[model samples]
Target: MVSERSSKEFFAVTLRVWRQAGPSASGRFVDYPATNVSPDMSFLELLDVVNDGLTVKDEEPIAFAHDCREGICGTCSCTINGKPHGPGHGIATCQLYMRSFKDGDTIIVEPFRARAFPLVKDLVTDRSAFDRIQQAGGFISVRTGAAPDANSIPVPKDDADLAMDAATCIGCGACVAACKNASAMLFVAAKVSHLGLMPQGQPERDKRVLAMVQAMDEAGFGNCTNQYECSAVCPKLITHDFIARMNRDYVKALFKAKFKPVSSASGGAG
Candidate 1:
């Protein structure tokens, strides 16, 4: 159903890709020339063209993970030229286009590197640590009978706006990749702040902070070095301001947990 005449404008580029046989296998960078690549094609599409050539040569195709290329799903994670989600600002890997690079230029691609994210294969790293963190009180447990009418509850405009901003995180692990210490604080802060801002989240706010922070630490994630690289590389443009908010809440929670009022009866018995 397709013809060469229908092809869009084409250019050439060299893809220097990381190749790993498996999680336990050694990895290295392999170069492949992608010729006649359409300028309008996305970076993933360019890889497909290179893969087609590899298939014809009976060679192993590059293994990468992607779903919902429109950028909502965070599965399309790749470190292009040492940057998470390629070189684009506030965009994910799927949003990267071939036109961003000059013709005949070489693009280096690799998987996100972090102690918490283990390599699955070429350009694929296991990000299940995020799931575990989320499971540890990232949500509210409320029994509100029905979906409340819009604006039913009076919420402060500033709080609502901040909540909405924090809610945009797609959990792509870009923050972790960008941080020198490989901290997950940005991601955790976003999750906590988004929920803590709303009325429905107030009930579990203290518990949520304590559990999620503990879970993140137990997952082998590094500490926040305050370098702010996490915010710089975030596709959602999530600010590091949320991390400060989380720190304040976490300290309060710790203090609340440490001190408790003594019961008169218990004190008399002691």
Candidate 2:
């Protein structure tokens, strides 16, 4: 648990932020002193203060991504001192508070590094790779008609609860950043399982698993060796067990696709 600091207490830290002009431009860490920082201030808020100082000095301010300052939107992604989403569990960078650090700390901030998530500028990375992967499968087609009653499709309580856990993934790409192999298995698995477990998703389960895994490989993400680091830094606290579930689904799908008649495989394998 994080200990609370006094409301009147203020501290200072050296912000070591990465600076880059473009995708191909050179980049380096530039340090700036952040003074009069309140413990209650969010990490992004501290960056805002630093940027304000830079703007006033006729210097280009730091670039970082953020939306819906609440942790719901995973747009605010960055590495702080080599940890994805900074020093906290189940919290995105936007949700990290200044109190997590000590006074006089040198905070190192940089973009999430991975071949799939190319760096844009400073702390921003192009995480649209996740979008492409999602577009490949991460959904179920529904008939365009009146909405069905919730109780019409009764799901087991256990399955419903597990599906909701997987659905919490916000596509932050923190898993890719945290893994030594830069594997996106956890992200793909969560996407696959959340929908695959539902009755509506059964029709395309095999297809979805195959397509998403293929897309993940094509996006240049490495294979998961099961080091389990991906789950270690996930802001959503998504478990690695989802990866196992996805792997089983992929194997079953592949086996059926190879042996079953094409016509018979249309509705997907068990």
Candidate 3:
């Protein structure tokens, strides 16, 4: 990745955006120009211009999901210019800048393509598969009225730090998108670790990892090959180490639950 330097005519970027109509529809890249774009404009704002251009041309505008236009929602997920969350460390695509490109640069944007992420529209995919995995018991099942003080339970600082690291997952799906096999290893492991680190998550304990991993497999997500690409592009910068931890948890879960996780071609989702 070479740095492009210019202070003039930053607009006129060539955008190659994937256009998908629906779940059953196959998508293709379409070119649109980013006219009058300023360097300071957020990447999505620049896309807004492009969409407006297409709408004026009476062509269907490319539909990309975004809200709060801030990076935190994790909903503004897109694979920008072949990089998940665009060109930088730990930044969402919405936080990317037009300055990352120069005039006449061709930018490619696409939805997160994973079997788990079934394309819902142009740049929006159904990530509820992740939600389902969470619902499969990623939580501590305490009745609502059982509110305890923030420090009710004393979690060791080391464990707390690790849990916080795992909890940093924004559910952006970048890990799934970046992997060659579209493995959701990082995402699943984060959830597993986030819960496994604390005492509150003890009730479900072994069952949580087992069930979530099973759901991940059934959702058609590929197994992690240890290539580490998923962790590399993760917006939260979650590491493959979490996957290793998850495997250990899963192995423990197998004995505790009395049900073994099915080992497929790639060693059962890493």
Candidate 4:
């Protein structure tokens, strides 16, 4: 049921945004009043309005990240009122609207906090760590030749569906922000499973998981403690089950690597 009060044309709210001059500099929250805010305005639009006001007054505008404003890019990452992507379910920050709040409400906005995602500026953090992890092994190698037909490979319906679900992760780093231990397992699991579930990924399955996991730990991300907060705040609503699947695959890979037989030059087991 829609509330009548939330449908009003415009309202006002206070934005308490964290302002940091640099990664090493001290930071604090500064309050800015947003007046006559339309209920239809997206959260990023609200920031733009506040920035316009600051520009008119010759003051520095708040720093934040945004792109494609349609919730697909996942570039507009921020914690609104202590919730990733703000007061919404299965939507990114760019999808959040001013109507979610009441007039005169105080909204606390901050950047995603995690050691792996270093602070770049106010409301923006360095997420290149994700790129690094992906580069470690999130791919399959195929010989260069004529493109294979779409139906050349037969994939089970269930596996294809699950692969697509895992592929929906936009690498936003929200999982790390939402986790109490700041873990990145959810993101890694999604990457691993989306490819691991497919026949094309079998050749490098064991190597991929091993390399990515090592890279994740090398990047200083914490391990998952099974709290499941990562899935709760996910904009795509990806289930935590992927994490378990990855764990099983990892164990199997380790066992296979340890016990695989070694053939002798004489064509007999060593």
* Best model number under TM-score: 2
lDDT of 4: 0.92
lDDT per residue, candidate 1, 1-270, as tens digits? 233333476778899999999999999999999888776788998888788899999999998888999989888889999999988899999989877887789999999999899999899899999999999999889677988788887899899999999999999999999899999999999999999999879989999999999999999999998999899989999999999999999999889878867556845545
TM-score list, all predictions = 0.91, 0.95, 0.89, 0.95
Candidate 2 stretches greater than 4 Å from native: 1-3, 262-270
Tens-digit lDDT track for model 2 on 165-258? 9999999999999999999999999999999988889999999999999999999999899999889999899999999999999999999889
Give the TM-score comparing model 1 with the true structure, all chains together.
0.91
Can you write out model 4's per-residue Cα lDDT over 131-242, one digit (the tens) per residue? 9999999999998999999989999999999999999999888899999988999999999999999999999999999889999999999989999999999999999999
Q: How many backbone clashes does candidate 4 have?
A: 0
Clashing pairs in 3: none
Candidate of highest lDDT = 2
Please write out the lDDT profile of model 3 over residues 9-109, one tens digit for every residue: 45677889999898898778988767777777789988888788789999888888788766777888889878788887878888887777777788899
Q: Pairs clashing in candidate 2?
A: none
What CA root-mean-square deviation does each model show from the true structure?
Answer: 4.4, 3.1, 7.2, 2.8
Candidate 2 local distance difference test against the native: 0.94
Count of clashing residue pairs in every prediction? 0, 0, 0, 0
Query: Which pairs of residues collide in candidate 1?
Result: none
> How well does model 3 score by local distance difference test?
0.85
